[model samples]
Target: MNIPLNRHSPTPIYLQIRNYLSRLIQSGKMLSGQKLPSIRVLSTSIQVNKLTVIEAYSLLEADGLIHARQGSGYFVNPKTTVTSGLTLRSNFSPSQEVIISQGGGSFFEQYTTSIQARRQQNIIEFSSGFPSTSISDNLQRVAKRALAKAGDTLFREDFPQGQLLLRQLIAQMLIQQGLEVSSEEIIITSGSQQALSLAMQYYLRKDDWVIVETPTYHGALGILKNLQAKVIGIPMTAEGINLELLEQYLKSHRPKLIYTISTLHNPTGITTSLAHRQALITLARQYECFILEDNAYEGLKFQPVPPPIKALDRYDLVTYISTFSKTLMPGLRIGYMVVTGEHHQPLVKQKLLNDLHVSTVSQVIVSEFLASGHYRRHLNRLRISNLQSRNVMLQALESYFPDAIAWTIPKGGLFLWTHLPNHLPIQTICSEALSHNVLIASGAAFFLGQGYPAMRLNFCHTPEDIEHGIKIIGRLIKNYLTPSFISVGLSSQEVSVSSMR
Candidate 1:
């Protein structure tokens, strides 16, 4: 392995290595079925992170130039078509254009600004993804009890993997849900967002191909863009992710990872069937790719749903991430992931470098809360309240919204995915709604490619607010559709909020 890296080049070191190897394989210098240097040996010879070498080899594998045998090193694929290999443009990458060109602001930036702007305006917001519940008296009591029990341990540096007690409780909860994970395998983070960041940083490098659901969680899209990974969006169908398109991408692209929200998916509120779960697991196994399953809203569902893709994973390929923010207070920010095998040590190291660990007080309190069984009781109450709120919103949409506008009836979760007529742009609608003191999430924020005319409305507000908000949005759409309004070429800014009120 005589590959050299350009310290001045804009392209990543991993891609540089991958390109060099690809050229060799295609040019016949590396023969078919011949073993290449092992990851450890090659990384030592080149003086780079082992993960970087792994990434380069993984890309070569994805390009069909090589294959790996367990307990053995990677080898040139015997049946590879040697056509100059996958080309890397000299001065361009898709990620450089993805964030700035698609939509300027990220989901976090947009919603944070929205929250601040509306803090004094008393705006009823449908843009939030979590239930806005205050800390209960019982939670306060639990926190005090946890503090009392902390003794001197709270003052000392704790494990990077997080509080063991919290992990044990989480493992028990997961066991009830059908996953065979233990406390040692779990790593606690500030939130599921941090967990996602760790996994992405560990597995994905620049120009690596990854698959995601179109209209997926905007947070994940933001992370992928930041990491400079190429994303392919597979549309969500009635059951789950479009398996047909997923498999096709698997065969042709050989993506490194599949990111999915299997149960109580955000924005759309679609849960896949058991068979759909099985098929997804099978596809990932056949393709020899990993799956990052975000089950953030799993606890919010009203009906019974299938176990997570992790529970069905026989090959230890799925990385399961979830958070207590959706069920508990969002400020708690306690999330965990179950990692096994080679990925564990690296992810833990990344976690240590990222923030050391989640807040000690937050982890301790949550641990005590779970141990006391208050968490289950809180979930039951939350489900009932959210269900009532959802029903009210549905009724309001039926009464105030036009027949042309449609929305999904979610079994559980905070959002209702609404589809607007293709002729209308969601960005204009969101801006006009904001002027009227109603904030909604424009669907444009959720896509990596071309976005559709849709919006995600949260059902976590009061019945009165939900009805009033829906009515205002419906009126805005109706006004936009009116013949006189359209003929006059009235802009969204020209629409009078006073008249609507």
Candidate 2:
């Protein structure tokens, strides 16, 4: 594998090596179990410092891409394949055909396939609503510091509700946002996804109706469908979820729960206004229903974040869920929920059965980080970075894509929802783009039951990478729309374009 050495470039030499090696491994050019050149040999070949090669190799090893031996060089591990695939086996029956008539089982398959396929490719992933790796370093450092101070005591089982310190920290955090939450009200879970799952388990019964946004987070959609809940989707507008339609659903179908992302809504990057929040809260109270507010993207906001729906909730019906995944780190998987009114006990019980509690070490570390002033400083840095990246992606999109493709300019959050012209087949475009070496998430995965012709592009993960990837996408779209190009099959060069696009 040849890695271009750019001494004049501002990028660190090690990162250049890391990126080159990562690309090679991802493209299957460097097979699993293949040994990378020795650090000395690499340093000699590249004419860089030996320590630079060592640093790059170490970084790659830490990322789970390769393993080091005492006497031998680094070798790619077999686990890389599974890690790259990101496929998890579900306990549910695999034979359940994913047909539309089969009650959304097939829809789950499409979601899983999109995620797994993206993981397998080397594309700059704007499809996932996850934080960039730079944010994770702070969390990791916090965890390490906690371990150094606490030692082996952290290995023991923690309180069923999670560490008290973390709970208190979470409570204080919520209070600052104008919610009068207590430590007892917060229940720690694996992540926001688990928090949502716990809420579903506590409230949803099979075939019970639930109201969700028309195109929502796929994971939430999957969980609700897995629970066998009859989901009624209210179409989202620039203002957020249509309150009138939501009320109509409440009146007509009497949904038990209304799951929403009010603050910096996912996939579409639209936040519900204060008026809409109050309206939804009032409607929930009027209908005597629960509002599961997923505020996962709350902290990632570039603009002043709006008050959460829970803050406006007076009836004790809003179950507020948020996580450090987007703001801090996704891998930490630390999420908390605030349950109000009479639902606290049952929800806590459901959480206990699901995973007993979130990791105690994670809780303590994150809590300590919050108390240390580190979290605040890190958040400041993240906000600036996110804002810059968001601007970069927006400019790239506007410059590269066709005028027919419309997108929302989100105030904050990782995603930008783009809609193709009505006649354009998103799946076909995605498939055709894949053949050209550019990968994009099809819009259909975001829908609850049927697919749509829109795609959610995450803009904050890698701005420069997104720029290059979108250029490929623009080129591919242009080719697809051209009648002359349609007559000829895609070539190998076109496939490369698709993969990167």
What lDDT would each prediction earn against the true structure? 0.78, 0.71
Per-model TM against the reference: 0.75, 0.73
Q: Ten consecutive residues with minimal summed lDDT in candidate 2?
A: 492-501
> What lDDT tens digits, residue by residue, belong to model 2 across residues 281-347?
9999999898899988887665556678888877788899999987776767899899887988888
Candidate 2 stretches greater than 4 Å from native: 1-121, 135-140, 482-501
**For residues 120-186, could you state the per-residue lDDT of candidate 1 as single tens digits?**
5478878888786566787788889998998888888888899889999999888757788989999
Candidate 1: list runs displaced more than 4 Å: 1-105, 482-501
The RMSD of every model to the true structure, in order and in angstroms, is 21.2, 16.3
lDDT for residue 125 in candidate 2, whole number 0-100? 63
How many clashes (backbone N, Cα, C below 3 Å) per candidate?
Answer: 0, 15
Q: Worst 10-residue stretch by lDDT in candidate 1?
A: 88-97
Angstrom error of the Cα, residue 285, model 1: value is 0.8
Best by TM-score: 1
